[model samples]
Target: MFWFFCAALVIIVGLAILTPVWRTRGDNGAETAAGFDLQVYRDQLREVERDLTRGVISAEEAERLRREIGRKVLEADRRAGEESPAARRNSAGWIGAVLALALLLGGAVWLYEREGVPGMPDLPLAERIAAAEAAYDSRPSQTEAEAAAPVPDRGEIDADYAALIEELRAAVAKTPDDPQGLALLSMHETRLGNLEAAITAQRHLIEVKGPDATAYDHLMLVSQLIEAAGGLITPEAEDELARALQLEPQSAQGRYMLGLLQAQNGRPDRAFPIWRDLLEEGPADAPWIAPIRAAIPDLAWLAGQPDYTPPKTAMPALPGPDADAVAAAEGMSEEEREQMISGMVQQLESRLATEGGSPEEWARLISALVVQGRADHAGEIWGEAQTRFAAQPEALEVVRKAATEAGLAE
Candidate 1:
């Protein structure tokens, strides 16, 4: 509206300047011609008087010349007076100008009303995230709904990996402050069902990531807690979840997990709305939607809201991490970026040697070396890994795969 008013004011002031000029165009021209003719007559009259004094012409001749010039000046004055501003004013131009201004202003107002948002206030990103977390926290706890929630089986872990696990544990203890070691330790510890150890490792991971840690990092920590509790939300996990949601209130995964937290706490009233809203608003093929759609009706029952009609959302799997990374790297040139990635790979290799790391770190090193086209180095790592995890074939497979990618498997 401010912009509209500004534009209108500019046009009106322009029209005001131009309208009088257009109307008086003919009258101004006539007055200018009259002034020029009067100046010519006055100059000739002066010459007539000078000639008479010098005796170049008689006084009688000079008088006749003066009278003739004076008559011509008077005639010019009469004509200028006859051409009044009213007579010379352009009525047609005045009409056209008024019509043009009206059209411009009217069209602008019409288009603005049709396409522009009238009174919507802008939402800053930080405020938006805070609001979302607050909304989630305000909802009821799903205590009554906890019993029927799905729990995935924690199948038996291979006993052969026990020795390798011990080695990694000792290596981590020696390098307690290393971020890479902690993340790697956390992943494998979770796989081995070492809940407390994994939780500790995850805390170290969060600490190492520090201020740069994103919502996804905090959310992952919460996930590790849920796993340790066999699909329950321990009080310890709530703090991590709060941090995640505070970072990104609109995070699809975070919201879904919040619903899970509510369900585990037996707050069906809260869980039902969270899941239902997420299902309706999220992408049609988001990975979390399928499970959410399935659970909505049962969650509704627990909420004592029987009118919940199940949405017929489809079952396509969501795109994975590779697609997401590719999307993020859209404007970067792969050829120029290879050198930077190679530098990082060298640094990782150096760190692993000096600080020591988990099997995951070794696997990452092999992969980075292969990506850098260092097949010889990758092969050496794979050989050492074979000796280190001889009993754990699964662990060796990670390094072996990277060796194959580097063309050293033969």
Candidate 2:
């Protein structure tokens, strides 16, 4: 069908060009300017003779007119007898028209051959979506993916480290229900490139945690599962992600993993918006932010938004004492300065508790408490921030940093 339309267009253009050439050629034999001039001169000669017969002019005057008209008539006759330039131009036109048509058709064919798919069928939206679904359904299982994945090469370990790992494995085996041992075993196994072993240990850790398992615990299991499958979000990993979200409905990590699953399963239409929202609700330093920014432009193109541009992101300003407050503190005595600083901290905490605040404010408050030798209170504030920013991974990360600095988290 495409070829047919191309051929029809070529023919239409050829006709428009060739029709003028053919018409000009056919009119080449018709009366030309020289012929018409000769006829006018002959008519003028006849008029002069009639004027002589009617005595409108003297004989000498009439004779002069006859000679002038006769000379013009002879010149016109000579010119009319010669071949016209139109004949030569008509002949050249035919050659030019043929050459132009040939060039047009040849260029069209060459361009299409270079740039177009000759036999591919049209892919409309519905067909494309169906194809994506087919690919999603036919994806390999976790075991198959792991089997096909390339093995990582960890250079030989030191003898002491290798012996320690073996001893840890034996210890974990003896204490199968020990969450701490399982967690340590998982971490060490992951470090040693034993992804399968890491996944097994993490799974056992979650099982031992049981009803006490947090969303973070399940997410850790999911992370190991995905790594074991060589970054493919397998069915087992997806199940763990669902469980994590069930435990904490506002889990940012779980939502990010969910978006990743959708992306891997040929559903960028679903993934793009999830990642876009995460990008917009950001503190700019979340672990997921980098990957989302890297992948979103392509996802948006796939989602039929070829013009989408990611929003700019920057670190939020943390709330704290201003320059004026620092300057005023320089003149006060130590005791008085302490009182003023304590009052400011208390005021910030009160406003945050009463009206809520940004993750930066929460983090600032946590840091302030820690500076005042209030580690226990910092831990409590960190817990509250985790719950408050649970749905926003970027925001949660900001507070998590302060909590980690206060020695409240690893």
Candidate 3:
């Protein structure tokens, strides 16, 4: 019985010892599997490196292959470490496996929470579109009713127009002498189909500001409005334009007005010359060139007539010292020179009003008028000089050049 007991104890001890060796053998098998996988990965890495060195594969491709192989090797190593036979043989190993599984599950959940699981990010877009469609569908009956309703009548429309007119009228009344207000009034009247009122307002503004580009712009608007109303320039309109020309002779506005005035006054002869001169002087892309060209077909036959000489208008002379003044007044003081200029301006204004003066006196007077804050007056004289000296274009050109050099135009 003692021998039997001893034999049983020895058997149990032997089995216990062998169990750990078996577990070690299983662990070795797992380790060998992992090592084999590692070797395979190392082989792939070496192949990629060789390909890169030989220029068979690009650096980027080799790097990607190496990274993939490394990831696979690392996963195999981790699996082998987690599931070794030695770990399974020991009670602690089983406990470790449970803990590892728990850790893996928790890590997976954490990763999913942090980096997101694949294919679940489109929820917001779908929800927003659904909400929009629902909102749109909810109001369909109201939308249909609104679409079927009749538009408001003209009385309602005129209420807004009347309000606008009152606002503009009040603005004009508040700033009675304001040229900008008057111009706005003119434009408003024009849009409202009141061309005559537009013209009158513009004319009043011109008289207030004297001859200027702003006045010319207003006049051009008036001219277009009037032509739209009907043809023929009225006598009062002509007189007002003549005053404008007197203020700025070389002004395109002045010349354009003069052409209209002459055409309406039964003198196409005069009008044709002015229009031709403007056409020659204007830029190729000038806004008025189109209208002037359209009028040209009507005047092409005039070119063949005996009285037609393609009347040349001179450019307005700029303000400056005349040759005689430069020569005779070299020894004068600044004050004395100013006094002389003042006297010359008076004489020129007087002669221009009367239409009786030599070109030399006219030149001096124009120069002096420019010096006396009458640049618009000088511009008108220059325009007139161009028309009057149509037969002497070169001489008038020389006179204009000299006036410009003497600061007459600026």
Candidate 4:
């Protein structure tokens, strides 16, 4: 379906570009050809005659100019008579036009084949969710030995967190099987880097969630297992990953972890397609996209294919000075740079005070102050932006994010 759209687009562009060439097949550059210069010379002679009639030029001067123009016109007529072979010129034009059209269409297809997934199938959101189910059904099921395998050790932890862990344990013990409590425990353990505990909590969460449990739930369990084993994808974890796909094949974390597991296990061929499809359908600005994009080139090479160039992502920029400004500052002496930076910010502030600016400009001012490590100044700008853009949520968010980055948020 994607290929069809691309082909149709190419056809439309090709027709639009080539249509004029096809229509003007008889244009042999004749209007500007040497043969047509005679008309130009005659026109010049008429202009001189008009000048004489208007009494702009004396009769003697006009006659001399007319004689010279007439000579050039006659010479032009002779060359045009020699050059006139309409059929030959028309044939040449036709040949050139045909070649141009062929190159245009052929080049498009050739480039797409070389640098693009020319005929790659499109996997819509609905289709990918269904595909996950099919993929899970096709994979080998886990063995009893794998299911019975013990959870990996989580190793040492800090005293403060360990004390909190005891409290979490007590709560879970009292409830026995509360899904919400277990879910919180799982996430908290993951945050504390206690993968073993996270895995245990997630399993209990799944038991309580039951059929209500989603593919994301199973996938998260697989994630905890892998992290606990120092990134080693155990058979039990793989089984959980399969269960995830069985529910939602397009689950971002599930597909990413599965592909990562395959790559780790030295099966880049399997990993490449999964990663490729994920990138195709994943949000350009999603947090997961950056790592996936960074890994694809290596994956392609491991698969013995040409290096892949993933599409650009929409990752947010750090809320501080832009690279160009930072680099320019780096080139200046410390004091000079400080003075210039201070002046630039001061100018922005003065303008905002004297002539109120937009929310975006306010956001920029706050970000600049943050980069300068002036939290107080950023906070001031944040307050002003809030008061100014209170009714506009989107505009307010821009300034609000800048303030938060500047450490001014309440």
Candidate 5:
């Protein structure tokens, strides 16, 4: 019985092996090699194209079918190609693609490096312009009277202006041909109340700098100062202003200052026409417009009147600092500087303890503080003066004005 069972198992195993060969032969019997039906597919595609050309299918319909068939064929081709050794053979083609990508990246980087295209936004142009304009427009923000005055420095010292003057002087010493520097120096000297020095600097500036706008401004300002001091305008000053007028034909400040000279020289008629022309051409919001208009009515009233006589009050000479304090401030160490400043404050306090500082002394102290760049100390001193000298309005007012001009006001 065991031998019969073994014989049946061998027969079943033999049939299992032979069955696969038979089925494989049968499945491939009607096809050619490589398991592909190439002729059948070719015939099917040709029949679809013929139908489209014969108008049996619409163009869009033919296109859609063509796309579908193309997608299927391409997918099949890829699958077959992947299964074969073709994918491995195409390594050079992949390298070519990599090289193409590298070339594209290199070109992009080169363009970016060469061009100045900003990578990010800065402050907007309009906002920057508005901020700049706001910085210059002191009229609406400050009181009308305050706006009329020059901006003061830290301790009523006009330190920045003085520094600018010193720098200009140094620059002129180094390079005498620097006209812009000379003109700037002239402006600074004028503000420092050194009219003769200012006029000399401006004369040099006009000769060297030639047609500068600021030089022109300095020339006008210097001319006005000369006329105010009851001095005749020098030939050099006259020539400088004439050149400036040529440079800026519509220079309102120049015209006004020239008119001031004319008025002072007892030629009201000459001054009147020049002023009238400026008033006609100037913007209503111009800084000098209101003053010019005010002067016009006064000029009309004084048409036939003699030129206004100069005031006889002899202007006091500018006071220099106390020698000891000047030397100490100049020579002191950082700690010693503070001590010197404190001592000055104490001296002022002690002075006020008795009869209080004179207005001139207050002005001098404010000037000293400004020269030393001690604005806070100056301010504290001013506050103390205000408290102690409240009964002396003249002194308080003078100190307060000095403080405001020095930019020490709270």
Candidate 6:
């Protein structure tokens, strides 16, 4: 039906263009203004001759009129001779009409062929939603996805490190319920590209934590599951994501994984808003921010907003000691390095206290305090961060991770 309408429109336009050329074809040899003027002048000269014969006008008058008429005739004849022949004019007109029509039709066809899906039928909103649902229901399982995924290359490890990993694995296998051992195993396995093993260890960690497992714990399991399946958010990962969000409704990573699951299951309409909100509520260096920024434009298009422009948000400057300070300290004597680091940490602490800072800065401050053997001060800062970022769950999560590392949180 669409093709029929296009063809009809082309025919109508073509006819409008060619009609004028065809109608004017018959008029090509018709008498022109110059020819008509020449004929009238000759008639007037004949009348003058009649007047002279009848003695109504003298020979002088008659000859004067003849001379004037003859001059006018010469000018009219010159103009007529300069005009193009009717056949040549008609041929050129036909050629121009043909070219115009060809360009119009051919250009339309070429553009459509280049940018359009030629034989695809129009998919209504309802049908499209149904198709998406079908795809979501039929997506691959976790085991199937992992089986199909290519093995990742983890370059050669040091012999001592490999031996340490074997010992860790044996320790975890011997005491399967040990959470710390499982966490260590998971981390090292992931580093060595043993994703399945990493996932298994993480799952065991979560089981050991049981009711004590926080949203972050489930999110860890989700991450391992996703990585093991080569980035596919399989059913197992989705369930874990839902459980994480259920445990902590404000979990940033859980929300990110939910959006990812929606996107993978062909529901960009659902995914786009989640990601857009995450992007807007950002610290710029949040782990999910980069991926959200990269994916949202296409997600917006998929959600029927082709003209949507993402907000331009600049990344905030790092609030702690800069890289140059660290490099300078690297070449100093141990005591000098310690003094330099202490100075830098004091500077960071002053700036953060005076102007406030991003969650990342707070996290860095907490870690630095722990490293300086000021666990009491670090605990005080962590307590303050909880109050400061109480309303911002994602930011609080960032600070909480550092607190956990410093033995300040579970």
Of the candidates shown, which would achieve the greatest TM-score relative to the real structure?
6
Off by over 4 Å in 3: 1-162, 207-225, 303-410
lDDT against the true structure, each candidate: 0.67, 0.78, 0.58, 0.70, 0.56, 0.80
**Tens digits of lDDT, candidate 4, 330-386:** 889989988887888888788876655555567788888888887655654665454
Best by lDDT: 6
Position 225, candidate 4: lDDT? 66
Ranking by TM-score: 6, 2, 4, 1, 5, 3
- For model 4, what is the error of residue 13's alpha carbon versus the real structure, in angstroms, after optimal superposition? 50
Model 6 C-alpha lDDT versus the unseen true structure: 0.80
Better of 3 and 4 by lDDT: 4
Kindly state the number of residue pairs that clash in model 2. 0
For residue 317, what is the lDDT in candidate 4?
49
Clashing pairs in 6: none
C-alpha lDDT (0 to 100) for residue 217 of candidate 4: 80
Better of 3 and 6 by lDDT: 6
Quality of model 1 by C-alpha lDDT: 0.67
Name the better of 1 and 4 by TM-score: 4
Q: Weakest 10 consecutive residues, lDDT, candidate 1?
A: 140-149
Clashes of each: 9, 0, 14, 1, 1, 0
Model 4 segments beyond 4 Å from truth?
Answer: 1-164, 318-410
lDDT of 2 by residue, 1-410 (tens): 76688789988999998998888787775346777798898899889989999999889999999999989888877776664665666788889998999998899889988998877887887887798788777878889978987674444455666788899999988989998899888767775667788888888888888899888878877776676566777777788899999999767668888888888877889999988888887647454675687788999999988999999876556556789989999999999998997898899889876656766778889999999987666665665555444334556677879877877765
TM-score of each: 0.39, 0.57, 0.33, 0.40, 0.33, 0.67
Tens-digit lDDT string for candidate 5 (1-410) = 54466468656654665555545445534323222544445566787799999999998988887777676666656555544443333444445545655675567557756884535435565665565445434222112322343433323444564576577788888987776677566655654545456656756765674444464455444453343233334344455567666766677756765776565445565677777776676555333344556576566444443453322333244333488778868877999887776677557556643533355567667756776777655665664454333323344566678777887663
